[model samples]
Target: MDGQPGHEPDCKSFSYTSLQGGNIPESEIIVAKRKMDPKTFSQEYEASFESYQGVIFYCFNRTLSASNETVQPNDVLHIGMDFNVTKMAAVVYVRRGDQMHAVDEFVTYLIRQQ
Candidate 1:
């Protein structure tokens, strides 16, 4: 195992001796025990693990992908909006052929007198 001190809070603790004694190879064990960045590990790793048991998008049957297409001048734009006292949000969509693509989203913060 590397000499780096283990200070990462989110990663599970494992001893070098246990890892070495196991049937698994040193390389694989080292990789499995490596520390993940706190922000990414917290947001993506924990959420995916807890919600889907390590399978991403467990609730969805189809995989969703992102596209880089922009809205054309002639394309019809559809907007959906949600408003609250503290925040407002909107989504912009454009129809291309038979498919509707979400092109942009906007959120604004509103300040209210306490």
Candidate 2:
């Protein structure tokens, strides 16, 4: 999919194949197994998000988007809210280290428009 604006390209799903054909090496299989582990995957995601410095916000529709990675933490996350809309947003902050700071924050918006 080209990076052109308004281009809704087709999405592809993951296709898994059996390794009985001896095409996949043993080391590759081990790494794949570890990555497939739920605990390991979650921890890796958390680590990646934590290490990255930026403002992450999830929209009211449970959509997660991170932007302004260059912005500092002291800066209040700027959000545009529609006055005519009946909805609210929740922010999730995750910190790293013994004294974790606001490295990444997720904002989830909830809409209850009739």
* Number of the top-ranking candidate, with TM-score as the measure: 1
Highest lDDT scorer: 1
Q: What value does the lDDT take at residue 74 in candidate 1?
A: 88
The whole-model lDDT of each prediction reads: 0.57, 0.41
Q: Candidate 2's residue-wise lDDT over 1-114, tens digit each?
A: 443445545554443344545566778767866655543443343232232123222112222333234435565444343222334333433333333222343344665579
Query: Mind giving the per-residue lDDT tens digits that candidate 1 earns over 1-114?
Result: 233356555555454444345665767544544654343343433333333343222333233434566788888889877674467777688888888777777888777789
Which residue pairs overlap in candidate 2's backbone? Answer: 58-107, 59-109, 60-109
Off by over 4 Å in 1: 1-65, 112-114
| TM-scores of all candidate predictions against the true structure | 0.40, 0.27
Off by over 4 Å in 2: 1-16, 38-102
Worst 10 residues of 2 by lDDT: 51-60
